[model samples]
Target: MMTIMRKSPINVRAAAKEASHERIVQAAARAIRRSGYDGTGVADIMKDAGLTHGAFYAHFESREAMLAEAVDRAGAESNGFGARVIAAVPAEQAFQALIQAYLSKEHLAGIETGCPVAALGSEMPRQAPEVRRAATRRIKEMIDLVARQSPDWGQPGVHERALVTVATMVGTLMLARAVDDAALSDSLCSAALKRLAPSDA
Candidate 1:
């Protein structure tokens, strides 16, 4: 027989449902970053995803489930950005590139699409355990990425340096976004870059 069989209705329905689920998660990721965890609502996320509020439960068991998935997506996006920044440079410059990108003006102004750690760190503890765990996992991944980039990687103090580097970058970005003064925001980013990057940077 030369003819091919079409996908079964059950498989098609499953695929469609999976696509809707992804749309909901992506929308929630941006929503959570734009509006902190406490501010993001299931209805808003569903609307943003072009779905009805009633469809949310079909994809997630609860609001916390959706938020946890959103956190993971947001963290993945940030990690991907950092990875791209590091990939653009030589191994020796990876750490500097990461620091520069994290504290860049573009990042400072792009809060909704930027690092979840900086945008949501303060609110993490107040979130449900699943959400907190999701954030913690990503934060640890970030720290580990920085550690691998450190010149002292595999040495005794590299992990500590990575911890400080991640903390400073997240803190600087948070403050830069928190301040109302544009001058102070720019200064915060610049000062962080100067202090955290290699002396040559």
Candidate 2:
């Protein structure tokens, strides 16, 4: 009698499911960051992930579900950026380091690898409810990171300052990206950074 050769269907199913799901989430995050929430469609995200649109529902209950997961992953990936910014300087130099990093020419030109808030914040409020909530939480976490680095600031006022700092950084980048004049863009970022720098720094 010849022995039967076979593959384990359960193991194969598990591996395929994990790979496909991760692919979909990664593709969605990239597309949403580049295109904003409304601009990226499920089909396009699936196509970019090398999976069929029909496979989307197997991983996500809806586009909103995918967006929520994508936002969370983006947040986690970006979680260390602010901490890294502050860690690279003396206490007196922390704010300036952050300012320079946020406003630099490299940041203005590199959206895909930089701040997700700068890339996605304007459209965030308009996103699906789940996406909006995820974005809001990520923004809070970023603010908290900046606040944690500054011991000189009052506890109550730290959050407000963080928000203003983030807004200025994001807005400066947005304006810089919009204009045909490269000089104007650089000037706006430089001015904002100068204003936000700690008085002693």
Model 2 is weakest, by summed lDDT over 10 consecutive residues, at 146-155
lDDT of 1 by residue, 1-201 (tens): 699989999999999999999999999999999999989988899998999999887888999999999999999999989999999999999988899889988998898899999999999879999999998999999999999988789999899999999999999999999999999999989988898995585
Q: Best lDDT goes to which candidate?
A: 1
Q: Give each model's whole-structure lDDT.
A: 0.92, 0.80
RMSD of each predicted structure = 1.0, 4.1
Clashes of each: 0, 0
| Runs with alpha carbons beyond 4 Å of true place in candidate 2 | 1-12, 88-92, 154-156, 198-200
Per-residue lDDT of 67 in model 2: 93
- What tens digits encode model 2's per-residue C-alpha lDDT throughout 31-129? 777887888899999999999889888898989999999887777666666568788788767767777887888878776666778788788767789
True-structure lDDT of candidate 2:
0.80
Q: Can you give the TM-score per candidate against the true fold? A: 0.97, 0.84
Clashes of 1: 0
Error of 1 at 124 (Å): 0.9
